[model samples]
Target: TKTFVEVQQRLDDVNSKLHETVSGAREIKSFVTELDELEKFDQVNDNYMKANIKVHKLMSLLDPAIVLISNLAIAAVLLVSSYLASIYTGEDKVQLVGNIAAYISYLQQIILSLMLLSMIAMFVSRGEVSARRINLVLRTVINITNPENAIKPGIIGEIEFKNVSFSYNNVNENDDKLTLNNLNFKIPKNSIVGIIGSTGSGKTSLVQLIPRLYDVTSGEVLIDGVNVKEIDLEYLRKNISYVTQEAIIFSGTIDSNIRQGKVDATKEEIEKAAKLAVADEFIEKFEAGYKSPVNQGGANLSGGQKQRLALARALVRKPKILILDDSVSAVDAKSEALIKDNLRTLKDMTVLIIAQKITSIKDADYIIVLNNTGGLDGFGTHEELLETSEVYKEIYNSQLGGYHE
Candidate 1:
């Protein structure tokens, strides 16, 4: 059973890789030589085929072994009974025959019981392996959880990070390697803060801490002057709406998907959110309008459309804090500008925009610049950063095609 489990795992891995390869076959053909790509695909295919063959072979042997054992037991019982009956005289022979019949019946019953036991053993072995896998998942301890006396803050959107540091590895806090180094920053209430950095600069990691998605290795993230770890988990998350870089849509009507943000939202409110996100224009064009069906993961929608819908979903919630993690990258410049304009109307809510493009965040109230080494380079307005931060200045010049001065 252990051997079968290991083989099954390998087969699953190979099948998953093969599915990915097939889905991206066009891209592979465009970038890779045909022969080389075929060889790689064939190797994975061979592994799957071999695993399948082995399973079939095992089934064939097991079934035949059970049948052969049963047949042999029956033949041995009959042969012994026949020989005993032939050697006995008149009355003795009759008694011997009756005894032989009883013995044969008992032997048959034993053989049937053994066959059933063999089948049960096979099933039990597989069930044990499956149960162990499920238990491993069930027994896993969640690293992030609400404290015993969690606070529920009355005020909503003031955020601060004090001398914060984080590492993916929880052990060895003294280790030199960290995803986010010691950092401190404050985002005032009802303000738009832009976070910009090169790849792997911990931009996402920093925002994730705001919601306690991960606990800081050291220092603290505070909300409304209270340590975030002390805040109730549900209360903290309910006040923040996060739209990730990749828009995730469910298999349902557009109305149903948007309603996920605010379950009891009215039709008017949903329409208002779509307009704010600049999604209503496209949605109205569809014959079904808001009732249009969205396939799984929004595969039926274009990238920009999916992003617009996600933005609408976030806006519909009227959250105290909204975080956009490169959510508008797929939208055109005109649409992006309109969305930014609409965001200005959300005066009571604090907003955080993490973007790669400088143009997307140039007009933000304050910009937080991070260096490649996971340290803060600057935190100020665009003009202030251009003058004071080399990293910010270089990025600005590269995107705008000139020196700020």
Candidate 2:
């Protein structure tokens, strides 16, 4: 009990501090999960402490009260036998001594039996209480709302966000405040739009809502003219392929990683996708070629190689809407340019590229520039935005001296 309580307290303290430091909602959730687990351990310790106290009290009564009374009874008999022996000096004295000795031996046996029974009772009580505690923890309820009256989204690639607002609890309104507020946007079918934002401008949050990672607090996100909340989650997600900024490549060969998207993809299709993503050159460099084993998260691979491999994985899915959430940020300028060029060749595909650098999205059909605050400061093509948007001019001047062709 002591050890468990100490460990629980330590974990809670450390995770609480971590919760304060981490800004991302995902990281905050992980810290909260850790805190919850520690609280459960603390509850178990509480139950164990209560049981230990009860057992201690019972032991005290068995040792002091019952043993003391038995010892007093034995002492009184010894005194009486000694007095009788002094009064009568014969075989009667011997018989009296034998009876006293037998009585003392019987008393010892009774005392030992009582101690044994008391110990058994204490252990049984502890067991029963521990069982109840474990059962309570197992039966504890978690708060997760269920979906109601949801419909299938079909294969439509339409996406829209209307008057969306979101806020987390216990954060400062003046400093680290609301991420997105009253935001409105639409992604038209077969249109390639790019979302550019400074750090913490809710870029990830905005795209995350398309897949309903989080429901908007007070507005609606619609897919194919149907509210996302009304659509079946599985059906909606199957049509969208999202490659995140963090390229996650599991420990496997190049072929295995690409085949992850479509398990039934043929060797020819896999090779074709790799070529399109510019991953073929690097794969061939390895001695084992396509069969070379990749380490966890592709740790051994270069940054550009990982990005290209992730692109291959996403391409193999042949999704209706491709959402690249800063997926090409790690690759070189030339490699990113190749991927961008390849994106243009995808027929009937709706692509959304979220990037940091302006060069990454210069050729995009439309670029939406987000300010440090949660608001859209500009939205247009590279040429139009440069001519009209102040933020775009500043970005252009800050990076490439001017928006030169």
Query: On residues 130-229, what C-alpha lDDT tens digit does candidate 2 reach at each position?
Result: 6666888999874223367767655557677787765544244343466776677777777788888778888887788777767666678877778877
Which window of ten consecutive residues has the lowest lDDT sum in model 2? 1-10
After superposition, the stretches of candidate 2 with alpha carbons farther than 4 Å from their true spots are 1-3, 9-146, 170-176
Pick by lDDT: which candidate is best? 1
List per-prediction Cα lDDT, in the order shown: 0.88, 0.77
Taking the tens digit of each residue's C-alpha lDDT, what string does model 1 give over 1-405?
765676667666777877877778778889876677678768877876787677668766776786787678778877887887778789988888678678778877887787777677767776787788889999999989989998888757999989998998864556677888889999999999999999999999999999888999998999889998999999999889999989999999899989999999999999999999999989999999999998988988999999999999999989989999999999999999999999999867999999998989989999999998788999999889988999998888888887555
In order of appearance, the predictions have TM-scores of 0.92, 0.68
- The deviation in Å at residue 25 for candidate 1 is 5.5
Task: Tally clashing residue pairs in candidate 1.
Answer: 0
